[model samples]
Target: MQPIVHPVVGYVCYAVYARWADGTPPASSPAAVAVVAATLPDLLDQPLYHAGITPVGRTIGHSLLFAVPLVALVWLVARRRGQSRLAVAFAIGYGSHIAADVPWHVLAGDYHELGFLLWPVTPMPAYSGVKTLGTVGGLEVTTLWLEAVIFVGGVALWWADGRPGLDLLGRRFDL
Candidate 1:
């Protein structure tokens, strides 16, 4: 998945989850946390891989081994801090990211692409050639179209949900 898609998907998931669980959209803080969590894996793995520090783009950060424990720790800390919702949002975002990367490959019997999910226990495949941006001029027309649809839907949902996190930016910038 592209980095742009991840956070949009995360926000949509959080909105859906909140509407189901709390009968409303997520609040600013949890929404923000979820968006950040969605990108956490790439943030951690991409730099290292591009710099030749790791063999693949989805090593430790994409591993369930790392995510499960980290989320558990986040849950524990958030519970203590009286912010369990934040932890849940984080889990949803992080889990969505991992889920987005794996299921299609698994269904297609491309288990080799999923080696990163186990990390050290299952060595990641070596870095393949760089992936293109999936833009209109790029080769991945289907991916570009899918991402565009998802992004448009996500923005629509966010707007309908009152743009929950917009206030955070306004407050931060004194707008």
Candidate 2:
């Protein structure tokens, strides 16, 4: 998927994470901090992809092994803060990150292999081939639409969660 779409998806997952936290701590809370941290690994791709210095699959950020350890570390930190919720929030975000990417991976294989979805648990790397999201037409249409659906669905679910104010992106400040 495009880097532009990736962040949007991350924000969608952020909304999910925030909803799971029920606004008691806010998205800026320790819980949200872990969620944001989980998204950090993807930020690396922005520079690498734009610079054209790195192949898509060459980055370790795409590795589940790399991410799980980082997630655990953040979870541990949140635990120390007496906030297990934060750790769980991070896990949700991280899982969302992977879940959001699956469609794209299914459509098009990364520059190299598919990616380390199974990672340390299983070394079997899958191949998406070049037919799925590889073509410009497919990616533009499918990814954008998928992002829209996830974004809307996440917001709706958050609303359904019965939280009072819409704290998304600090929008509460507008009121």
Candidate 3:
């Protein structure tokens, strides 16, 4: 999945969870956390891989080895601070990111890409070359279209939910 899609998925997931849990729209702080957490895996792994610090772009950061423990720690800390909702939001974002990366290859019976989930227990596949954007034309045209659709839908939903985090940014930037 592309980086842009991750945060949209995170926001949508958190919005759904918030409504289901409390019949309320997501608050700014948690919404922001969700967006950042959604990009955490890539933020950690991509730089490391590009630096040649890791063999693949999806190694330790993408592994359950990292996510499970980190999320548990966040939950523990947040619960103590009476901010468990934030932890839940983070988990929703992070977990959705990992899940999003899996389905496409799995549905195609390409299990080799899944080695990232195990990290040291299993070797991740080498970096695949980048895919061209839909406008430019490539094998990933369908993926780009799907991402675009999801982004548009997510934006509409966010707007319908009163644009939870926008006010926070506006206040900070005086926009």
lDDT of 3 by residue, 1-175 (tens): 7888888888999999999998998998898888889899999999998999998889877999999999999999999999988999999989988988886566545678789898979888874533333454435555566778989998898889888878889999999
Higher-scoring candidate on lDDT, 1 or 2: 1
Off by over 4 Å in 2: 1-31, 34-38, 107-113, 116-141, 158-175
Q: Compute the lDDT of residue 173 as modeled in candidate 2.
A: 70
Stretches > 4 Å off in candidate 1:
126-141
**Best prediction by lDDT:** 3
**How many clashes (backbone N, Cα, C below 3 Å) per candidate?**
0, 4, 0
Candidate 1 backbone collisions, by pair? none
Pairs that collide in candidate 2 are 31-86, 107-132, 107-133, 108-133
Write the residue-wise lDDT of candidate 2 on 93-142 in tens digits. 66666665566655554433444564434343443432333346444454
**Highest-scoring model, TM-score:** 3
TM-score of every candidate: 0.86, 0.58, 0.88
Instruction: State in Å the error of residue 114, model 1.
Output: 0.8
Model 2 root-mean-square deviation:
6.3
